[model samples]
Target: MSSPEPRAPRYLVRRWGQLLLGLLLYGIAISLMIRADIGLDPWTVFAQGVARQSGWSIGIVTIVVGAIVLLLWIPLKQRPGIGTVLNVLLVGLALDLGLAFVRTPEELWARILLFAGGLALLALATGLYLGARFGPGPRDGLMTGAHARFGWAIWKVRTGVEVTVLAIGWMLGGTVGVGTVAFALLIGPMVHWTVPRLRVPAAGDPPRPARRRSARAQAAPA
Candidate 1:
């Protein structure tokens, strides 16, 4: 089913505001996961690893990494939208900002809670930004673009990329722990549950058709 149409002025306010808020939450989530010290997602793990080796902040590494990934999209003929650009800029900045205030807790249970909460927030952030319909993030675009260009299954593309990153990041001294396991298990379902409800209509997005008919009906002259 199509989303309800949201009108201008108010639409712009809600759209951009939600996008920014989502990005902010996403960055904070990344920071929380890092502070949790249990594990990190593959992309962040790669960033953390590179940061450790390069003596840069993880957030800086994240931005640099995103830009590089976006560049890869060009060869695949992917065009980035405003959301994509903001994803590159704001997420890393927010992460750094979050880190300035967030601390790693010593207790295991607290760390676990923080890690779980971070995952939940990340899922919601994803839905919010995506629902705004500005565009997909660099990483997501890379996957989708690859799928479009090479005709590889989405799962194949995503898995290969993530595994490669995870291996490289782990080799580079990024921490991988129970949190990683938790993320892998919970993220898909959590995002699935949240996205449909949380999504807002994107500007200029087409509405979904109400229903489908049989082949004969579909093939009939308009």
Candidate 2:
């Protein structure tokens, strides 16, 4: 008999802790974006624009958009894991709370620096949070679900979604400035570089059953 494949770890407290840290990092990132006076991420841009248009708080717009995204998960049969749900909720809450105290930068150079710094911080947070392997954010989960359903490349699907969000956000009055363009170009590379370094060893788990394969087929393949 063959040995089982290794399963991913499932430490609830540890995962939650990672998520909390990610959330804090995310907050800092958003604060930097605001300070930059540049555009926010596509999702945040949409939320901020909607908040401005509808006279709703940015947090409220975030919740609404998150709920809408969460609904998309149901049809895909993707359950909302803890990290996923928290991501939807905590990001908005953090933005609101952080903005309460943090002031936007007054100078153009300061704004530019803050924007770049924000992107880096956001990338770091994403790496740490995803490293926990708990679950993906709504947007990421949506991309994953689409990839599974349509056999599309994850990057293509993700890019299309972000483009759509950016368009809508721009139409609704979100700041789509140099920073937005910079982030669009830089975020993926930053996340790729940071995630492996940030990933901790998968702890407290045993192996799972490996899928059975035919020996002749394996031999034939290479």
The candidate scoring highest on TM-score is: 1
lDDT of candidate 1 over 115-146, digit per residue (tens): 98899899999888887778889999999999
Global lDDT of each model? Answer: 0.90, 0.79
Residue pairs with colliding backbones in model 1 are none
Provide TM-scores for the models: 0.88, 0.82
lDDT (10s digit) by residue, model 2, range 55-162: 987876887798799899877777877778888888878777777876877888878887888888899999878876768888888989888877899989888888
Which candidate leads in lDDT?
1
The 10-residue segment of model 2 with minimum total lDDT is 1-10
Off by over 4 Å in 1: 1-7, 202-222
Give the count of colliding residue pairs in each prediction.
0, 0
